[model samples]
Target: MNILKFQHEEDFAATGANLIASLLQSNPRAVLGLATGSSPIGVYAKLVEMHRKGMVSFARASSFNLDEYVGLPADHPQSYRSFMNEHLFSHIDIDPARTYIPSGNAADLDAECRAYDKLLEEQGPADLQILGIGSNGHIGFNEPDASLSSGTHVVDLLEETLEANARFFDRLEDVPRQAVTMGIGGILKAKQIVLLVRGEEKAEAVKQALQGPITTQCPASLLQSHPNVVVLLDEGAAKWLK
Candidate 1:
C-alpha cells in the first residue's frame, strides 16, 4: 500500500481526483468503482471542477458505486444513488447510460445481488475503485466479522456504522440497519484502489487499517493484501498513525 498524507482534506481530495483523471485520460472507457459518504464528498467536488475546466472527460467512462442502504429508494434524499447524482453525476458531462448504481429497492434481492456481481464481472476488473473506511474500519458495508462475503450482497450495518451515518438521517433510528455492498473479493479484484480518509473521527480507523493485523475484525485491514492500494489521509485522520 502507498500512503499519502495531506495537510488538509481538500489537498487529499484534489490529489485523488488527479489520479482518477489521469486514468480516465489514458483509458476513456475506464471502469470506475465509486464510494459515497462524507469521506469522498470533497473528491467528487474536485472532479466536478475538473469536468467544468475540461481537464477530464467521463463521457465514455463507466461507473459503479460501492454500496446502498437496502430500504432507501433510489430517489430518496438519503439514498446513495441520490447522493451520487447530486454530488458527482449532475455536475459532470458523463453519459448517464454509462453509470450504474446498485438498486436498493429490488424486490428480489438475491437475484439483484447476483446480477450486479455479473455486471461487474463483465466490465471489470475496475481500473480504479474509491473507498471510505467506516468508523469500525469497514470498507463499503463489509462490516467487521469472522468472514466476509465475496460478491455484492446484503449486510446488516454495524452499530458503529449506523452511529457514524446517523448524521444524514432525521433520527438515529432512521439510519437503515442493512445495506447491499461489494464484498472484499470484489474490491480486491480492482486493478487499483484509492482509500480516502478525513477528519479526526476517522483517525483511529485509519491507524489500525495501516498498522494493525490483516483481520476480518477490521475489514479495511484486508487491503493490506491488495497489490495496488493507495491510502489518502488528511492530517487529522493520520494523527494516530506512527
Candidate 2:
C-alpha cells in the first residue's frame, strides 16, 4: 500500500481526479469502480471541472458503482444511485448505457446479487477503483467480522454505518438497514485502487487501517495486500497515523 498525505481535502480530491484523468487518457474505455460518500464528493467535483476544461473525457469510459441500498428506488434522495448521478454522472459525457449501478429493487434479492456478480465479471476487474473508508473501517458496507463476500450481495448495515449515513437522510429511520454491495473480491480485483479518507472523524479509522492488524475487524486493512493501492488522506484523517 502506498500512502499519500494531503494538506487539505481539496488537494486530495485534485490528486485523485488527476490520477483518474491519467487513466482515462491512457485508455478511453477504462472500466472505473466508484464509491459514494462525503470523502469522494470533492473528487467527483474535480472530475467535473476537468471534463469542462477538456482535461479528460469519459465519453467512452464505463463505470460500475460499489453499492446501493437494497430497498430504495434509484431516485431516492439517499440512494447511492441518486448520489452518483447528482454528483458526477450528470456532469460528464459518459454514456448512460456504459454506466452500471446495481438495482436496489430486484424482485428476488438473491438473484439480483447473482446478476450483479455476473455483470462485474463480464465488465470488470476494474481498471481503477475509487473507495472511501467507513468510520468503522468498513469498506462497501462489509462490516467488521464479515468474512467478506466474493461477489455482489445484500448485507445488513452495521449501526456505525447507519449512523454515519444517517446524516444524508431527513430522519435517521429513513436510512435503510440493508444494502447491496460489491464484495471484497470485486474490490481487490481492481487493477488500481484509490482509497480516500478525510476529516477528523476518520482519523482513528485511517490509523487503524494503516497500522492495525489484518483482521476482518478493520476491513479496509485488506488493502495492505493489494498490489497497486494508493491511500490518500487529508491531514485530519492522517493525524492518528503517526
Candidate 3:
C-alpha cells in the first residue's frame, strides 16, 4: 500500500486522475471499478478536465460501479447510476453500453447479485478500483460485521450510513435503507485499488482504516490485505496518519 498525503485538493485530484489516465494510455480497454460519494467527486472532475483537454480518451474503456442504493430508479437524481452519468460518463468518450451499475430495482435482487458477480468474472479483475471510506470505515456499503460477503450482494444500510447519505436527499426518510454492493472479495479482485479520502470528519476513519488492525468491524482496513493499493488523502483526512 502507498499512502500519499496532499496539501491541496487539486494535487490529490490530479494525481488520481493521472493514475487512471496512465492506465488508459497503456491499456485502452482497461476495466475501471468506480465509486460514488463526496471523496471521489474531485478526482472525477479532474478526469473530466483531462478528457476535455484531449489528454485522455475513454472510448474503449469499460466500467463497473461499486454499489447502488436499492429501490431507486437508475434515473433517480440520487442514484449511483445518475451520479456517474452526471460526474464522469457524460463528459468522457466511453460508450454508454460498456458501463455497468447493478440494477438496484431488479425484481429478484438475489439473481441480480449473482449476475453481477458473473459479469465481473467475465469482464473484470478491474485494472483500477476507486473507493471512499465511510466515517465508520465501511467500503462500497459493506458495513461493519462479524464477517463479510465474497461476491455481489444486498445489504441493510447501517444507520450511520443512512444518516451520512441523507444529506443528499430531501429528508432522512427518503434515504434508501438497502443497497447492492460489490463485496470485499469482489473489490479485492481489482488489479489495483485507489482510495480517495478527504475532510476532517473522515480523519479518524482514515486512521482506523490504514493504521489500525485489519478487522471486518472496520471494513476498509481489509484493504491492507490487497497487493496493490494507493491511498490519496487531503491534509484533513491524513491528519492522524503517521
Candidate 4:
C-alpha cells in the first residue's frame, strides 16, 4: 500500500497515467484493468493525450473494465461502454476486439458472470488494474457485506451508491438498481492495483480504507493485503488520513 498525495489535479492525473504508461511501455501487450467514474476521468484524459503525443501505445495492449450498469444497452449514453469509448478507447490505438466490459444486458446474467470470470481466469490476471473507491468504501459494486464474492457477479445497488451515481443520469430513478461487477477476489488477482481517489467527499472513505480494520464492511480495506497497490490522492481526498 504505497500512498502518494498531490496538491494539484494535474499532478495526480499524471502520476496515475504515468503508472499505466510505464506499464504499457515495458509490456506492450499488457492487460489493463480499468475503471470508470469521475476519479478516473483525468487519468484517462492524460492517457489519451500521451497517446496523441506518441508517448504510449495501446495497439498491442488489451483492457478489461471493472463493471457496467445492469439492464443498460452497450450503446446507451450513460453506459460504461459508451463512457469508455468517449474517454479512452476512441482516442487510443487499442483494438476494439481486445477490450472487455462485462455484459450487463445478457439474457442469462448469471451465465454472463461465469463466462466473464472464465475469460479473466484464462487470459487475464491483468498486469495493472485501476480502481476508484466509493464514498462508502465500496470497490466496484462490492458493497459492504458479511462476505464477498470471488468472481464476476451482479450486485444490488445500495441507496448511497445509487445516489452517488444518480448525477450521471437525468433522474435518480434512471440510475440502474443493479450492476455487473468483478468481485474482490477477481480484482485482487491483478498483478498490480492502482486506487485513485479525489474530493473531500471521499476523505472519510480514504481514511477507513487505508487505516481501518480489514473487513468486508469496507471492501477497499482488503487492498491492504495485496502485494502491490498504489493509492493516489488529492488533498481533499487525503484530508482525513493520519
Q: Which is the winner by TM-score between candidate 2 and candidate 4?
A: 4
lDDT of 2 by residue, 171-202 (tens): 88988899998898899999999999888899
Q: Score candidate 2 by TM-score against the native.
A: 0.98
- What are the per-residue Cα lDDT tens digits for candidate 3 across 41-104? 9999999999999999999999999999999999999999999999999999999999999999
Candidate 1's displacement at residue 126, Å, is 0.9
lDDT of each prediction vs. the true structure?
0.91, 0.90, 0.96, 0.96
Which 10 residues in a row give candidate 3 its minimum summed lDDT?
233-242
Query: Model 1: clashing residue pairs?
Result: none
Q: Residue 36: error of model 1 in Å?
A: 0.3
Tens digits of lDDT, candidate 4, 156-232: 99999999999999999999999999999999999999999999999999999999999999999999999999999
Worst 10 residues of 1 by lDDT: 95-104
TM-score of every model versus the real structure: 0.98, 0.98, 0.99, 0.99
Q: After superposition, how far is residue 145 of candidate 4 from its true place, in Å?
A: 0.8
Q: How far is candidate 4 from the true structure (C-alpha RMSD, Å)?
A: 0.5
TM-score of 4: 0.99
Worst 10 residues of 2 by lDDT: 141-150
Residue 67 lDDT (model 1): 91
Q: Give the TM-score of candidate 1.
A: 0.98
